[model samples]
Target: MVSAARTATETRTTTRTEARRAPDIVAGVADADKLTDEIAATSVDPRLWTGAFATNVWGGRFAIDGVLGEGAQGTTFQGTDLKTGGRVAVKVFDVGRAKDWKALQLFDREADTLKSVDHPGIPKLLDVIVDQETGARALVRTLVPGESLAAEVKSRGPLSEAALWSVIVDVTDVLGALHGRSSPIVHRDLKPANLIRRPDGKVCLVDFGGVGRMRESAGSTVVGTFGYMAPEQLYGAQTPATDMYAFGATLLTLATAKEPEELPRQGLSIDVEAAAAKLSPQLRALLTKLTAPDPSGRPADAKALLAELHAIADAKDRPAAEPSWPEPMVDSPFAARGTDGDFLVGIVGVVFGVLGVVGAIIVGQLLIPLVLTIIAATADGAQKERILAARARVVEAAKVAQRSFERSAQHGARKLESASERERDRAEHRRRRKRELKRHWKDEERRLKQLAKDAKRSARRDGRFWV
Candidate 1:
């Protein structure tokens, strides 16, 4: 009987123990379900949560949408900034696929340089990502919208003289800023492909992987496009003037719609004279000086080149010297004119007088002189009309050109404004979403606190502790 009583007590104790642990087990399961629901609700792409399992780069903050371009060292991708819903360009350098250490060196240098500079003509650095597992590095920057000059020229024929001049002005302005720095930075690889024209008609210089200082150690690995590289750049002699030579080559490429190397050469140097024969004299002269065989032959710097360009532009803008009017000979009959207008008035008076006299000379030689005067007046009037018409046409043409320029500017401004509005809307949406999430978590926390309070009260009433 004593053994049976002991077994009964043990069974009751075991039942109470399970009753106490039941709430804890249920709470743990509820938390797991809540986590799964949160993930499902918040994730735009659930696959991105898997990190390395996904094909995209940059874990969770950024997602690659498409490839922008690929070079020998790395590839650039168009990506989305998940946090802000903005677009970005991500340049990924895969260590495993790199041909040599030079690739990494260039990559790191590009990252460093981008981080240091601030310019509208240059991309703004957003983030630097290093994947420890893959040993890959990525640089995230604001994507400059537009096609490269190379692609632009390929699809559309060579740019007009006005368009080419616009490009030159924009690029040189950017180069001026870069080269004017305390420690000059040479864009060792300035080529058509590396220059992007933005939608707003501004030029953006990109691909800083090959960028270097003005003076570097000898025997440094040559870094630049073959056709656009300066003669000295081949020997690791990079300088500000080296970039000027590349700039000239790039302009030649755009002007001719052909690669620089494709053009005829003068010994080791490009035949700038032959290649630029079709360009204006001023432009041809500028190209000749820019692509000179020796660095000393080129302009000293961007500033000096700009000054020369301004001078040329000023000369073109000046009106041609008023054509010298031959002095009327002292014996010439036409010298009697007071002015063209006075001459016309006198001729009209003579016509009226001739008509009055014709009645008296009905059979005289005065008839012939009357007809001659009328013919002279008609000829003079016609010549005045022609001159007026020519002036009107010139004025109209100038107005049309001005309107074209204004229209282009307005169109670009509208596009920029539209883009900014969309960005603002996206930012507002993000803020609203963030506020909603905050409110949701607050409500969740309140519910949990109340449940805990109720559990504690129930344990006290039942004369037991809740696990």
Candidate 2:
């Protein structure tokens, strides 16, 4: 009876243990189902969530932090490169969307172009990603730290001449580098909005979406901003000069404190000179040449335009003879009353030798009278003749230097004239080409109209016979 009682107690304990384990198994299964449902909710529609992903870390690599800007092509996100822990600008294009096909092509083209070219003024392409879920493409580029030139100009009004010159020089250098490439690249959209001014006072060119190689065939669609685009570019013809035209239009806007499109237009051309009347004559002339109705009237290349710009700067910096010196010995190391006056004169002459005629004249005006007075007051006849001869030599050297400068200036002017002549010839050729194109298009239109009329007439005759 005791053995039966002990067996009954063990069976009761086993039943309690089994009853406790059944609910635990059921709860575990319920938890798993809940997890599966949550996962399904997250993964069901990538299109809805893909853009949201840009708010967090993307592709497990880029940490999308903020929206930098958006364009017609794609939205640019300011992000962190998780691999390198550096700042990056990620341009995301939803290729699954039908409207973004052209944008995808442009984004791909920009990436390819950036990969091929290297310039400090250009953003470096770092990485490219294709999301499997959404089929979206992302182009990662190094974040160029700066404000857009357009923004700067808008906020600050027109830039100072010095600031403007600096911007022009920086952009021209970049353009020169691009145009000098083996297969010359043209930034079809060379507008103020596409340029960035760094804190270090350097300007960088960005947005290669409209970049094109000179040798490539023209695209079917018209590209670039209307006011900034050259006449030929509107008809799918882009050349280095096209960029020059855009550059001119950009400058005009900056100088005039107005949008290129807002400025008065003469037929297809912007009246740049009238709009930018406040700018210097040289700059005004440059704007005219740059915004010429004909592509041939613009600078042949960036290098050519750069040369002209440098010449303008040189002219501005060229010293002129003043009636009086403004503190002649302000920064001079030589003492005015030194016993070794000849030594001081020699030093002045040495300084002038390097400064061309302007420096020589200034030094002469300051020292020659002083030197002559000293020689008259202290030196013997022989020393006086020697000092006078030295003065004469210095004057002669100054005249020679002046002649050389004139010759150099003349040479530069002649080169500019030659460029203008060449440009005129090209303009004539382009005009002929444009005329031919217009004629061909008109003829084709007429033919199409006639064919349509004939078809309508045939249909009418057939209807009458049926009646």
Candidate 3:
């Protein structure tokens, strides 16, 4: 009995010690919740941590690896969905406790949005997990395998106008699709960093943590990248025009290697023509109009902006042989809900009429095409590596934009065909009606002539009788 009791005590003590020795693991989170008693640095995404990673939310045992990238809104970690073993990008608002449950709700809402959406460029939504105990929530999505636009800009340097336009068009299509919905979705934030270009040359939008609800009946939060944000967005008004403004700004940034808002304005207001004089003047005018401080001055929604992009594409290139694939931004569909924290980052779509110029990069006294560097290379390794990357991205983005423009044209062609068919039917019906009317008028004229002839004959006969 004594020996058995000693063995039991020893086993119990070993069990407790082992439990204490295990590392703390927080799942469904990528950052330390300031609200929690314990705060930690975000060295790596918690989701990517397979060996042992923990958040305030939950703990899990997993086998995965790789760190994709990080952003202000959320850090994206490369990992696998525990169930299916599929590679995925886990985005979580692990920082700052609850923040009024907005983070969790956004995660839930984005998941619902992802489920309803399907597109190649838009990452596929595999699963949404909410920790029962910790209340931590996350969106499980297919990993976009490529460098971000920011990475491209950073490593490659400023892209060319053509390339910049391509990326803009690609993201614009994604945004256009989202905003094209009946209620419309405004990508509150649109920056090169938020965009990713795949090896296949496809561009996609990532990070929906800042996404807010834009009801036809209500308002939305003003959230987006600083340099790329529209004036209205910066002022707290969310609208599709605001996004256009940001798009223009992004283009300008790539062109000039300067922020849109920082451009030397003609006095207080920006002279779109002057701000982007380095680009095609027409492009400069369009961008200026888009970045107009007043919401009234811009295109009403993403589709119209798409139309303008098509126009640009048309003037620049010819049509493609086949239809292009669709790239959805902020994928998923769900019912709209509330909270001051229920942030639909952009406004619901609206009807609009309109468009930005690429900025010119100034390289000190000697204006060399370089500045944004990727991976920071040793001096003289390859002179102007950053410049090369920028040039490459610009070329690729232009091709992409050109392709998206062609795709839109394809849609337009279908619409045009429908309209032309209707017109032809109307014209044929009008022609038949005209023929019937003409035939009836001729018959009446012939009858009237015969009557006149008879009257004259009777008059002659009467005259002869009188004589």
lDDT of each: 0.69, 0.68, 0.56
Which residue pairs clash in candidate 1? none
Q: After superposition, how far is residue 159 of candidate 1 from its true place, in Å?
A: 1.0
**Model 3 alpha-carbon drift over 4 Å, by segment:** 1-62, 69-74, 81-86, 215-222, 234-236, 267-269, 313-467
lDDT (10s digit) by residue, model 3, range 80-196? 555545567776545345455555666666676665544456775655555543344455677887888777877777777778677766777677656767766666777777778
Q: Stretches of candidate 1 above 4 Å error?
A: 1-59, 322-467
Stretch of 10 with least lDDT, candidate 3: 348-357
lDDT of 1 by residue, 388-418 (tens): 5554554555455545545544554554454
The TM-score, computed over Cα atoms with residue i paired to residue i, of candidate 3 is 0.54
Worst 10 residues of 1 by lDDT: 21-30
lDDT of 2 by residue, 272-375 (tens): 55776677888778888989878778898898897787567545543353212122233233222233333444445444434554554555544664576677
C-alpha RMSD values across all candidates: 25.0, 25.7, 35.8
